[model samples]
Target: MTDGLEGARERRVRTGEGVELCVAELGDPAHPTVVLLHGYPDSKEVWAPVARRLRDRFHVVLYDVRGCGRSSAPKPLRGGFTLEKLTDDFLTVLDAVSPDAPVHLVGHDWGSVQGWEFVTVRRTEGRIASFTSMSGPSLDHFGHWIKKRLARPTPRRIAQLLGQGAKSWYVYALHTPVLPELAWKGPLGKSWPRILRKLEKVPAGAYPTPSLPTDAAHGAWLYRDNIRSRLRRPRDDCYAHAPVQLITPTEDAFLSEQLYDELELWAPQLTRHTLPAKHWVPRTRPDQLAVWISEFATASEPDAAGVPAQLAAPRTGRYAERFGGQLVLVTGAASGIGRATAFAFAEAGARIVVVDRDAEGAARTAEMARLVGAPDAWPETVDVGDGQAMEKLAARTAAEHGVVDVLVNNAGTGVTGDFMDTSVEDWQRTLDVNLWGVIHGCRTFGRQMAERGQGGHIVNTASAIAFQPTRALPAYATSKAAVLMLSECLRAELAGQGIGVSAICPGVVNTNITATTRFVGTDEEEEKRHQDRTTRLYGLRNYPPEKVADAVLRAVIRNEAVVPVTPEAHGARLLSRLSPRVVRALARVRPRV
Candidate 1:
């Protein structure tokens, strides 16, 4: 065995056909094994990112399939790359690495296609403990999907078939005689990395290896040898014998989400996760994939009782399909809209980070978030207006919880007074919390999102007063207006980086801000009276903060630039744009003291 990446032990496993397969292993031999299989036109190097992540917790292994990378190709190239031969190669590796123990399996693209064959076959049962598949579907299930659709072709079914057929255009190209090999040996192989970077947003690095031309030329047999025969006579008894986890990239160019609509029929124990990403998740989303793989593999381990391992139950939440397993950070999550937003994302199965100046309140919110359905939740205490404190928080969050997938900057203070009555201190305080707080969040967390190169979203809580002017609320309105403009500018700047920025404008909702609001140019007794009166009026309006929370999720999902929450907010926004004079006239009416 030779030493490779991170002191990985490298060896060779020979198949019965005398083909040498290159295998690399990391971590302790005594630990549970996790075997990672690469896909078409790629080598074991494609799994380097994911393997590095799993090595600490499990025995991670990666191998190049025959005819790719350092693996030796079979003698007769035409009938060399059949699925049965691939299965034999997998079995040989498993027996050589861990003969006494079952191994957890992970596959991407064509590797996933091969894994479907492994876990479903009776001869391979009990040797495989669990399977995690991505970016590929089972040929048998696909065959059944097509047969059912053709047997009774509804309009929706026809559309799905046509859509998938269009996506499979490359399959036809690969099936051509000698053309694919020529293309791979010529210009196509040299430009493959550049094409992946431009089209799929795969990060540029030392991947696809120097032998890509030979690898791809030989990989064409993967499609030509299996697809036609399997689809025509797919096995009827193809059911998985182990717990299965399926991670689907929602934006994969080669596969449609509809392809797995009836997957439950084949796999009785199934857990599904969706990622808002394109193809090549191993390169772009290795962190998230590693986390999920570790969780599934750990759950599949048998207990001391020697009973069969029980898989985790699937997450059944409203937005689980969109945000499950993602990290979300909500600032000012101690009360009002911020706390409600945290709870909403938690209910969607996202991990939550609650940040607020009130340490106890933040901790309480984090605890409640776990009960609601968050996989995990943590609390961080810091005043959003404190730039240094926010910078520390951002660094700690990235280091501990990974890069935040969604950020909600909902911290603000209420100020009500005439321009002259509002002192300079009051103006500075409001701007510090309302305007500068949002700036701190976007600058700190948004920079991390940009650096990570994966897409994310930022939500800033502006107010209806941003566009609708009022004489009694000058300082508060100005601060909120700046937030709205900042969100717009950031949205335009970050569009190219795949980051989304949204300004949530709410009119009036019953919350605690009114009671804490400052009244300028008033005695202590008079200020107390004004606070009670304003709180009463807002309570009578009776708008719930939960509604605003719902709008925040919608804005992130749709990547909306500006969203008006309340009905009055919508009307006010329209009036401000369509009839400015009418809006100004309405704003002239002052609130009663």
Candidate 2:
């Protein structure tokens, strides 16, 4: 017999890494666990009410993610606060508390970013079943979004500059050892409440100022080591693949909502949710949060080994499950692997938005997406090769769906020809779809998510050809390689902004691509001859597109930027790394069909 109220209080515990974290335990310990991570300017106390609600059904856990609240914030910072370090912090807590068992994970603001990254990098989705994210974007898309949006006229520029300056105040201070200490001890401490109050859309009469110290220093370390460093170290490869739940507070004062455009490219296995509260939804609507957490912690799913151990896993055993309510937008989604990936995401529980140049094909795919259990699937016909059209599509999709929590830039074209045979138009079209399409998605939706200050995810489709280019198809190879590089660069650049970027690469997939692509030739006989030559020269075997979709889901959860979809592709990649010349020679010795 228990009152279930004892769980709401904060406690201190040691993590696997020997770091002592100030943890708040809510709900009965006997029930399944749910770990809650707090963001900057806050503590575990904010989750008290929410924890209480879940006490009877869930063993809810809340902790300050290494710094802030009662967690140990070592002088000069312990382990530094890069996303990898931050992810380790979460893992430490989980491993120490839950051991090898899985738990439900929930995060808000910076917490959400860390949560997603933790599950991906640690491959802890096996131990941590689901994620409920509030306000975070994929780092890759976020950087592209910020760059494009900030490049606008004077007013927007001024606002961005001011916003970055204001938000970066603590960031600048943390660069030096002396100022962080001074600020923590003096004026910065005194103004903490006022600053936090200004950042929220809370009514004046809602709650008293939290009786917590204004230690912005601990939080600033995250920005410096994780955010800023990632930006400076653009082109680093880091991506995550995991199932996530994203919650957006409609009335958030600090983070805007519009930046979530084309977020589906980032997390195909994402669920979109909303709360009609202020920035402090955990504090304001704690009970609702608790209910959601409880539901997520108790749900179950099958664990399949559909994904590689380095990527994602297929549904197999029963595990805790989270609700699904995400809207995913996929560009170049109508045919080939894009359509199959869209259908796969839908089957995993997502509202799908199928886009392509062919309206009828897109509609048919949308119908399939819906059949796979998407709450609502939409189809839009647009030329991904056109920048203006992509912008319009992004805007329209956001307006229609409210938020694109997941975005997959799976639309691309492969124009295979001898470098000498390929014209400028061939190169432009290939670049337009393969590189520029992804760029457009990041700019349109990523900016909106960034302005909103919530983090999101973006997935750009490249090809194995990007990693190990063949002598032929120079234009196609260059375009895909560029996409891969772009995804890597964005991953580093947008770490602080909370956006994650993953570059998806698949081997040859069986589809109508040979027929649909604009392959220039004289007559029908000549085109057939070209096709036969390509088949004979490459010895290409088409894998199913659904397999690529499975790979995409895995990549998202694991936060891997470079995802090779096939065993052959992986082998080729390894060969390229070990001996480029040997790999090239092997590729040259293709068997004739």
Candidate 3:
């Protein structure tokens, strides 16, 4: 056993930047890979034991994130040190080392903050299999949390000022012009530990400033610049969709744990743990942290690669087993897509509230939802187009179920008549149900969901038509388009509040929607004939609504903002984005059915 450390190994690998990271590898390379990122004022040595303990079963890789111990610190440029640049640095290292595969990731301190940043931004998470964050908060949430905690009158304000002042010394030094030259050339060479310890104790009111040169300002400036740039731009521009695990220390003696209050805002399925330790968890609690990392690494399944059955289906707790116990309210829950969606959520074990304007049809759907295996289900005949009715139903549901964690705003009406044939009422009605109904549900229930302070998911049903409007159904398509924009706006607004919004765009689902469309028909026979012709011309195939329902649940857990339900929907979204002119031309050319 080589005296209790036979499995340990280390090597040095140069990055694309030509900086050599003292890479430490533990466990078997054949095992699933897990990468560990260490924060500033520390080096890869911090994760030594962690790598050792996990080496037997995981291909654990530990390295300094950048500009830390045993790694080179390049001079900062205008675009350097940005989060995007930092994320690219991580990716560069990962590609150079784990080129053929994705790996489970763990980061602590500054590294964790970067990890938190990477997971919440879309471009970065696709490459990560899973993430574990230690002492990191969603940056946006942390800023808000800190401001709120420090905003009170008197004592709290005094405390905040004191804390901010203490931190400001380092912050200001970086902004100074000659700080970098001084720190690099001054007599305080290699005094990193002293500097780190002083900052650590000062924030907790335990230490006095030690004599240090203003030259140390260079490093401080890098941090200040990064923080400023980050604040100016929100994470939504870069948010990634990756499952996360967060671990906090009880006695960090620096940043407050309050920064992590609303972590679900970034990753809905976030799992958290708090350990009794200090800022140096990689050094102080390596063994314990290693155990946690190993479990998470093995627990997450790789979607693109072959993940073992044991790891993919890792058992959940008794509590997790009852996920279906939650109540799922879906609007437009009568026929067609809505009916299929009701059945889908029900199959997942959620209690269904089948809501539609058609009382009798909604009741039948409620029964069908139960038959589909929902734990318990019911029906509500409420016109979604009616704002007051929506508020009342949302309030009553919250009162009855205690909470509605998942809300699918699926109710909608369409018209196939030409734009010239559409009246003001027709346009307004389309807008009322297709656009305003979604807004009402979001605002009325969204406020309550936010107030509850629990994680919630809202899926608003848009249409493929939203991506490209046809002249024949201008009112309907325009309303759906407006709904799409609204969903995007809400997703951004609610991200920091732990409320998720997903815009679901489904292509034609085999539903009886055409029969219900408000058209200029003189008689029942005419209406039926028109509906039949519309369906036939559209080449409508009845897609099981259950597929969309499942996708909604998955999107919620993944915290995804967009849900395209079919290949046609995906193609429409792509065309709208890549070649709008072509999309418009195609839409304009389609003859009225």
Q: What do the candidate models score in CA lDDT, each in turn?
A: 0.90, 0.66, 0.67
Please identify model 3 stretches exceeding 4 Å from their true place. 1-322, 521-526, 536-540
State the lDDT of candidate 1 residue by residue for 1-593, as single tens digits.
Answer: 32225577889999999999999999988888999999988888888777877888899989999999999999889989998999999999999998878899999999999999999998898889899999988999999999999999999999999999999999999999999999999999889999988777776766878888999999999999999999888999999999899999988999999999979889988999999888798887876788788888999976666455878676777778788878899998999999999999999888899999889999999999999988779999999999999999999987666789999999899999889999999999999999999999999999988877778999999999988999889999999999999999999999998999999999899989998899998988999999999889999999999999999999999999999989888988998999999988977878777
> For model 3, how does the per-residue alpha-carbon lDDT over 38-100 read when each residue is reduced to its tens digit?
664345555655666667787877765445544455465434455666676777767755777
Residue 12 of candidate 2: its Cα lDDT?
71
TM-score of 3: 0.47
What lDDT score is found at residue 391 in candidate 2?
Answer: 84
Worst 10 residues of 2 by lDDT: 314-323
Best by TM-score: 1
Of 1 and 3, which scores higher on TM-score? 1
**Model 1 pairs in collision:** none
User: In lDDT terms, how accurate is model 1?
Assistant: 0.90
* Error at 462, model 1, angstroms: 0.9
lDDT sort, best first: 1, 3, 2
TM-score, per-candidate, Cα-based = 0.89, 0.50, 0.47
Give the better candidate number (2 or 3) by TM-score: 2
